[model samples]
Target: MKKVVVTGVGIVSPLGIGKQANWDGVTSGRSGIGPISLFEPDEGLITKFAGEIPEFDATHWLSKPEARRYDRFLHVALAAGLEAVEDSGLVIDDSNAQRVATILGVGLGGMPFLEETIGQRIATRKLRRVSPFFIPGLIANMAPGLLSIYTGARGESWTATSACASANHAIGASLRALRSGACDVALTGGAEAVVCHTTIAGFNAMKALSTRNDDPATASRPFDSGRDGFVLGEGAAVLVLETEEHAQARGATVYAEVAGFGATADAHHITAPRPDGDGAVQAMSMALQDGGLAREQVGYINAHGTSTPANDKMETAAIRTLFGDHAERLAVSSTKSMTGHLLGAAAAVEAVFSVMALQQGILPPTINQFASDPECDLDYIPHQARKAEVEVALSNSLGFGGTNAAVAFRSAR
Candidate 1:
C-alpha cells in the first residue's frame, strides 16, 4: 500500500484566514463565536451567536466579476485549495497533474445563497429572477469542481455530502484512492458557508444550537455542565495529501501520515447519536486497528465535541468504552469550543489541528470549559493549551444521520 501523508494545509475559518492564524486562535483558546453579523436573525431566534469569518475579500482570489459568478462556498474552496497547493510547493505540471484528485466534504452547500436570494425571489413570486448560476452554486460537488480547476486535479473529482461527516469522508476517500494506487495526490477537505438567518432559525427550531446570546464567547462549552448546544460556524479548510514517496520526491515537508481511516453509521437516529455510542466505538477501534496502533499509543484526540448535551455525553462514553483506562491518559479536546461548529468543515479543520498537535507538540484547548459534567469526566485540556509530545493522534467526526468517522494520524517525525 502506498503510504499517504499530509504535506500542507490551509484554512479560512472564523478562527482566522490562514493556517498560522487558525492555529494561534485555537491554541490560545480564542472563541470565534459571536453575534450574527452576516445577516440579521429573526427576532425570536434563540441562537444568535455563530462563528463567521469577519473579513473575506474575493479579490484576493477571484476577480470582481468572477467572484459574483460563483457562490461563496466556491470562492472558499478555491482560496483554501490554492493556499494548500502553494504551501506544499507541489508543481502541478502536465506529467503528474493527472494523478491528482479533488474531493470535498460539504455539509451544507450554497445554503446562504439559496436563503438570501433564490428563496426570497421565489417567495415573492419572482421565480424568473433566479440567477443562471443557481444550480452551479447550490450543488455540493461544485466545491470539488472549483478545487480541481484551481489545482488541476482532474482525477476522481467529487464531493461527500454526508451531512456533518462530509469532510472526514472526503479525506477518507482520498486516502483510499492513494493507498490503492488510484491517485498520487489529492486536495481533500471540507467547506461550509451557511451562517445565515435561515440556518440559524432552522437549527434553533431543532434546538440544536446554543442560546447563549448574552455571552457569545462562552456559548460553545463542550463537556461542560452549562453547555446548551453547538454554535454554528462557517469556514473552508483544505489539506494537501500525497504519497510518502511522491512527497519525498518533491522534497515536501511532511507533517503527519494518514495511518488509518474508519467510517460507520449508527443506523439509529437522524439527528441523534446512539445511546450506547457503539458506532463511535467501532469507528475508533477500526481506525486504530487499521493504523496498526494500540489504544495506548494514541497520545491525543481531537474530539467531535459539538457542545450539545447528547453528542458530548455520547462521545465521552464512547471514548471511555473504547480505550477504557487509557482514555484517561489521553489529552482530549474539542476545538469546537473555540471555532464553534464548522458543520461539514469541522472534521477537516480538526484534522489539521490533530496534525498540528503531532507536529508542534502542543495540544489545542477546549475553551469555555468552566464547569464539567460528571458523565464527561476526562482530561478535556480545558481553557488553556498544553505542551506535550504526541506520537499518534485521532481526529473524530460524528455527523448527523449517525455518520461516524475516525482518522488516525502518526507523527512524520
Candidate 2:
C-alpha cells in the first residue's frame, strides 16, 4: 500500500480562522464557546450558548453570486478547500486533474436553508415560493461538488454522511482510494454550519446540549465533574493528502503521515454508546493493527470527549480497555473542551490539531477542568498546554447510531 501523508491543512473553527490562529488559540487553553448569536433562543430552549464563528461572512469567502447560490456549509467547505490546495502547492491542470479527488463530510448539509425555504413557503402559502437553488444548495453532496468545480479536481467528488463520524469516514475512504491507485491527491475533510434554529431545537429535544447560559465559555467542560452536555459548534477544516512519493516529488512539506484508519458499529443503540465500549475498543485496536503500530508507540490521543455524561465515561472505558497499562501514560486531551462539538466537522478539526501536535511537539490542552470526574480519569492535560515530543498520535470520533471511527498518524519529523 502507498503511504499517505498530509501535506497541508486548512481550518476555520470557533477558535479562529486558518491553522495558525486555531493552533495558538487551542494551545493557549482558550475557549471559543459563547452565547448563541446566530439566532434568538426562546425561553423554552434549554441551551443558548454555542461555539459560533463570530467573524465569518460568506460574502468575504465567496463571490456575491456564488455565495447566494450555495449554502453556508458549502461556503465554508470551499474556503477551507481552496486554502488547502494553495497550501499544498498541488497543481491540478488538465493533465493531473483526473488523479485528484474532492471528498467532504457533512452531517446536516443546509438546515438553515431548509428552514428558510419552509418558512417562505408557509408565509406565502404558494408552491412556487421556494427558490430554484433550494434543492441544489442544501444537498450534502454539493459540498464536494462545488469544491471540485472550484478547484478543478475531476477524479471523484462526493460527500460522506455518518452523523458525527462523517469526517473520519471520508478521510478513511480517501486513504483507501489513494492506496488503491485511484487518485494521487485528495482534498478531504469536513464542514458544518448547522447552528440554526431547527438544528438547535432538535438537539435540545434530545437534551444533548449544555445549558450553562451564565458561562458560555466554560460550558463545554469535557471530562469535568460538573459537565452537563456538549455545546454545539460550527466550523470547517480541510486536509490536502498525497502519497509520500508524490509529495516528495513536488517538494511539499509533509506535516504527518496518515498511518491507518479503522471503523466499527456497536449495533447496540441509536444515540448512546455501548456500556462496554466494545465498538470503540475494537476501532482503536484496528487502527493500530492496520498501521502495524505498536500499542506503546502512541503517545498522544485526541479523544472524542463530548463533555456529555455518557460519551466521556464510555470513551474513557474504551481507552482503558484497549491500552490497559499504556493508557495511563498517554497524553489524552479533548480539543472539544475549547471548540465545543463541531459535529460532523469535529473529527477533521481534531485531525488538524493532532497533526499540529506531532509537528510542533506540543499537546493542546483541554481547558475548563476545574473538577475531575472519577470515571473519566486520565492525563487530560487540563488547564494548560503541555510540551512533549510525540512520535505517533490518534484522533477518535464516535457518533450517534453507535458508529465509531479512528485515524492514526505518525510524526513525519
- Prediction-by-prediction clash tally: 0, 0
| Least accurate 10 contiguous residues by lDDT in model 1 | 39-48
**Highest lDDT model number:** 2
lDDT of 1 by residue, 1-413 (tens): 68899999989888889899999998899988888887777788777779988688877998887788777888888888888889889888799878999999999898877876688888889996688888887788999998887777778899998888899999999999999899899999999888877788888889999998899999999999999999998888999999999999989999899999999999999999999999999999988888888999899999999999999999999999999999879899999998989889899999999998899989999999778799999899988999999889999999889999999999987
Clashes of 2: 0
Which residues of candidate 1, in runs, are more than 4 Å off? none
Please provide, for model 2 over 1-413, each residue's C-alpha lDDT reduced to its tens digit, 9 standing for 90 to 100: 79999999999989988888899999999999998888787787778889987698888777898798788888888888888888888888999999999888898899988887666687778775578898999999998899899889999999889888999999999999999999999999999998887888899899999989999999999999999999999899999999899999989999999999999999999999999999999999988888889989999999999999999999999999999999989999999999989888899999999999999999999899999899999999998999999999999999998999999999999
Q: What is the C-alpha RMSD of each candidate to the true structure, in Å?
A: 1.0, 1.0
lDDT of all the models against the reference?
Answer: 0.90, 0.91
TM-score of 1: 0.98
RMSD of 2: 1.0
